[model samples]
Target: MSKRVHIPEYEQESELMAGEELVGGPAFWFLHLCWWQEDLRALVERFGADPADVDALSDRLTDDDAPWPVFRVPFGGGHTAVVALRNFPDDSGIDYFVHHPEWGRLGHLGQMDGHDTGPGLSWKELTAIAADVPDGAEGLTDPAERFLTLLPMLGDIDTPHDAAAVVARALTQCGIPPEHAPHIAGKILDNSFWELPSWVVRDGSPVPVCGASASPRAIPLAQGITAGQARDLAEALSGERKA
Candidate 1:
């Protein structure tokens, strides 16, 4: 279960190295949305993998303790895709590589270096997003819970509709019926919600400090505000009015 059965050769390869060019595609995005083993198995099968290999790859990926997990997915006619997970201190992301019989490993996929705009949504922004939820929207009551539910989709959200889709997905994940989830999502976005105060980083952590007179309360960095947002919050806390 720890090693991939589809491509056992990869088990001996060094995990430290990856392709130079990061890549992504429909499969990559689909993989991002998959959190459960069954869904992953389905994805592997769709890529023309053997039934046994499909199960093996899915199990290996879901294993939390698997060291430097990597897998080769068959894409038919001798072409394969190599998927690896890159871990960081604060986050982890997947990278993809194409492998062919004639040519070895190709470009890397899904590299975010120099492309990421840092953290996506701030706590205040998330609060604003959650505030849009209607008074009685089922399973969306707690602001903190709503924020955590929406965290995975934050980077992809650009519009209110995108936010609604994320909410709908979250609702579905919470066991709400698919048909009802969208209806509830629409209702959640129909009204505006109140905003929370911005936060400043004090002692390498986020502290909720709105204005000059407000007392700062230190909170974990997991609160989700970016460094830039923290600086602005600091200025506001210091009573330095922006010109």
Candidate 2:
């Protein structure tokens, strides 16, 4: 839901230069992510996306607004949405899918390599395209967080391994010690939102850029991972034992 999500062109450029809040006429172009069935619901929910912003995106979706110009994406849940300058790539958007059930709704499904789309497009094609349009998305950012939100959308994943990985990543982003991570992978089902795929569509696929941001923020997985998982990753990566 690129432009469908509602990010202004000018603000899009500014965000890339510096990942700061939108400071323009109305809204900015960027992906809005929701987990599980909470996609659209999260928009107006108490802690959901700002009302002003939702109002802006809603306006665009309901009646084509300027800058946004058009928003033709369809949402299946209340948990995920992407606001940007243009619509998400062809066959690239999603509301719900198989794989994980507890992670929530995965907005970007076809974009992940070797997963989401079910290899409909060759891995070579995905890899090549992703390399050129690494972000596939023109104005999306925070791929890491987006990825965390998509963990529930993944297919062919080993619950233990994937869950452990997600828990570990969430711990780092949340600024918690890796040693304290619970290290549990929520669970997955074709209709489940947990264990989602990457939300940031890289060349129309899900990918994560953990630690890529100067100021890292926790991914939605923070909602699932326990302290034990994180500490495990920390120990494995740093070989440091905290007393």
Candidate 3:
């Protein structure tokens, strides 16, 4: 028997408005996954391209340098829906716009306030792109890996259960067997396997400036060291312990 998930009435309404049958949970999750991967890739490429000037690299890593078009969905009539993260100066969220072949760009469909809100684009205006996402693409096949990859992007979620629900839903959407979502979620929570960066608003814009964020499990894996060796890695990274 399939598990009965209880979606809030507001979310149900949003789903209906967005065409639940088309850009449902799977498509939504896939869009976010694409954005997350692209954002990381852009940052790494920038640093790799100019590794000599650390200060210049830091200055260039602002929202202005972020790669756009988190993902695109092509529709009939030569129209395409482009999804991307809202500029930090505007607000921290996701938004989308449609593009016509001859007419140029259309206006935004809607904006979602992080993962707490509804889909930014509607199915009436956008086609399902999740179905076309190749399996194992970007090396994101394992449920645990997917959850960890998405953890940093989930800073808006406060409640533990809510975060777990998001992970479970995304896992199921991304082709993880439905029956295994609960177990995977449990393991993730038990291990506490991810770290989140701290953000601050600078000159009226949110910036991820703190680089000392570390998780108990992540430190060891990051340094390719055993748990015993990483016992003080978090403290050292945070400058809480002397070398």
Every model's TM-score? 0.27, 0.28, 0.29
lDDT of all the models against the reference? 0.37, 0.28, 0.33
CA RMSD of all predictions? 17.0, 16.6, 21.1
Model 1 C-alpha lDDT per residue in residues 54-133, reported as the tens digit of each score: 45544544444445454333322233334555444344555443334443334222222223222223334444544433
Best by TM-score: 3
How does candidate 2 fare on TM-score?
0.28
What is the per-residue lDDT of model 3 for residues 5-39, given as tens digits with 9 covering 90 to 100?
22121111111112112222322333333333333
What clash count goes with each model?
6, 67, 0
What is the per-residue lDDT of model 2 for residues 113-195, given as tens digits with 9 covering 90 to 100? 12223211112212222122122333213433433333333332323344455545543453334443332122222233323
Which of the two candidates, 1 or 2, achieves a greater TM-score against the reference?
A: 2
**Least accurate stretch of 10 residues (summed lDDT) in model 3?**
9-18
Model 1, 223: alpha-carbon shift in Å?
42
What would the TM-score be for candidate 1 when compared with the true structure?
A: 0.27
